[model samples]
Target: MKDIQSLPPGPKPHPFFGNLLEFQRDQLKFVERMQRTYGDMVTMHAGPRPFVLLFRPEYVRYLLTEHPRDFMATQSAGGDLMEVLGESLLTIEGEAHRQQRRLVQPAFHKKRVESYADYMVQYTQEMLDTWHEGEVVDIAQAMQQLTLRIVVRSLFALELLDQIDEMGRNFSQMIEHRRSLLARLLNIYVDLPFTLYGKRMSAKRRIDAFIYKLIRERKAEGQDHGDVLSMLLATQDEEHPLSEQQIRDHVITFMAAGHETTANALNWTFYLLAQNPEPREKLLQELQTVLAGRTPTLNDLPNLPYTEWVINESMRVYPPVWAMGRKSLVPFEMGGYHFPEGMTFLFSQWVIHHHPDLWQDPNTFRPERWNPENDEKVQPWSYFPFGGGPRICIGMPFAQLEAKLLLATIMQRYTPRLIPGFPVVPKPRVTLRLKHGLRMKVERTATVVKDSVTMI
Candidate 1:
């Protein structure tokens, strides 16, 4: 392996602005072009600041796992994300991050997520019931509602469907406002009000208001509701119980990040399955054999191996959280590069997961690659859909369980066929979702019941 500084050379960036112009235009395309031009390690200057883009799995493993302390997460990029997430675990660092993680980890424990599985299946089935056979439905929006309902139910144990439309509107407006060019330009200054920055500020106020109201209601009841929200309200440290702001921040963080990523993942999985029927057939076959028309539970997860593999494969190709950025707090040495302190170092899953050198037929939609029989043949870090190391997504296990259960449940009931000539393109928004929606013609399958009767 070459030293960090001596890694593969990239495009010569213009002075002052450096590669900022190209990146601002379309980040995904810019990274793809750079990867094609400069194998794994690409050096580009973002506004006079030299940042190295590490694409190799080995390098990603080193930074995220081996030298974490040296290469901490960059607040600049994540700072924008915090417009919605607040100082949730995703943004905090060091001791504060650790403390927050400890406080929040209990809610996503295996038992807890398992308990939520029944709700996931039930909600998905309920949503599917509304889908008409010939009616063209937006699969993405449907999944969004299904997953959001599940999140709301599991998180608060409260019915939120009535308020869901409002919540979705505010959330979408906030994310868009923060993602716009004007937001980026305004972000150049640290002191600007979030309103001045973009449309997200008002959305934040609305969301926070709702969350705080919910928290206060729980507090007024002063009862342990046996839900995640109750657990959060019950959580406390020796010095202080989580402040109202803290509760609202973490709740809203999970509420938004929780459903959106899994929904997009399932949406892509369905779209991919539609485009490639063989994989879809295999997945359904596995579900039929393992589940036998019944809803999958935590116990059934181990048996539904193919379903797991398909979701993993989908994530490999289109990871919802596509990129990871770390700003060097101090100089670090890897691949022999002398990265200066405070420079942002990025490792994009889009680059590593799709690299020709790392994967066979990198661009193909092949879930079999993740099958146990073949997956062992690949390098350890060759594929990371939920990321790696200590900073890896904490909700990964929860998300996986939710996705697989939902996939199995839906496949048991309906077969969605993607409409022909409909342009299906992946857009790198907050998550990798269809720029448009996946319009699929869902055909209701014959309902299968137990007692020695089966129908397809």
Candidate 2:
């Protein structure tokens, strides 16, 4: 506790508020400034709490793995997520987390998750089918609606294709309110009228009622459908099965993470592809040669190396789950400094992914850098799109396969181009979303259609 001066250097704190004000203005820019001015590990304060920002991959490896037990996931950072998601694997710890993870792990296994590829491509095709040539569309919104429907269908075996518009309308309203400042700062779940929290809970209940109704239907069916809900229903032992509330938590967790995170990845990938025609062209070529105008499958995944690289590079630029905050559960020691318990530790995917030292041309969207022929090996703990270690995202394979299938399926049918003269920027909320969403014009591909009619 007495070694405070040995901590990493940072901007001088305000006498009262510390560096909280500066941080709130623009978190990404402020962290970038801190890394440049004070090196990789910068110490800043949120109010009176000390937070050390760790940027290096070695430091990331150390914190998430080597000294993993010394720190704990902070509720302050994911508290808002908890209220909306309840106590599924994301917010729990210890034996409960392990147990829940074991229950859910089977759903994301390679064989099982891969079997859903047809559903992935089918849903993607359904969405693309609605998009006529020469039509203008918000690709980001399109992706959100698409992924939400995909997750709902693939996870629950329920078709929301026709109901997507209504479901998405309510879900988006809920998500917006859930991620609002009042919802985050206040951390109150009560439904108060004319307030964001109130609206969020209302929206949540709409989704919840739907989910619980489905759960009841599935329960009454008394047969396994091989969907996630069935697995939850099947789980029980000498002890006890999960309560309805717990199952709802897991369902909501999957709904938010499965749809939201993957949609952001797809949205940003197309955003980059719209600008970088070379990579996009190469991607189309791969789909033409390998897939030959057909949709991509898990079997084709390994063969489409360039397609994977494009998404990798996109994530490197804009990781969906950026920045993780944790609290020291014990007196923590790392980077040659000592910290007492309860100190905050901050890690930024944006900072680490863009660190000039780790990535050459860190700001450049060059997927070729990741090509196997280039012999480019990502340093351990450096490129964590879905995080790392034992607690690394369970849905990683699900997301990767889903994104690839969607990209390949859509790219086979249309060439997406960003609308001219629209400023696209990152809106870093719980997940990094596009500010105005990716507004783009879609042109039918010659492979899928002969006409050059535009979709905008």
**The best candidate in terms of lDDT:** 2
lDDT of 2 by residue, 99-204 (tens): 8888778888888888888988888888888988878889988998889888887678888777877777776666666544333434455578677778777777
The TM-scores, one per candidate, come to 0.91, 0.93
Candidate 1 least-lDDT 10 residues: 189-198
Clashing pairs in 2: 133-454, 133-455, 134-454, 134-455, 134-456, 135-455, 135-456, 136-456
Model 1 over residues 286-396: C-alpha lDDT tens digits? 888887777777789899888888898898888887777888788667675666677677778787888887789888888888776765466777777776787777788
Error of 1 at 219 (Å): 1.6
What's the distance in Å from true for residue 424, model 2? 0.7
- Model 2 residue 227 distance off true place after TM-score fit, in angstroms: 0.4
- In order, candidate lDDTs are 0.78, 0.81
Candidate 2 Cα misplacement greater than 4 A, ranges: 75-79, 178-190, 447-456
Q: Which stretches of model 1 miss by more than 4 angstroms?
A: 1-8, 75-79, 179-197, 446-456
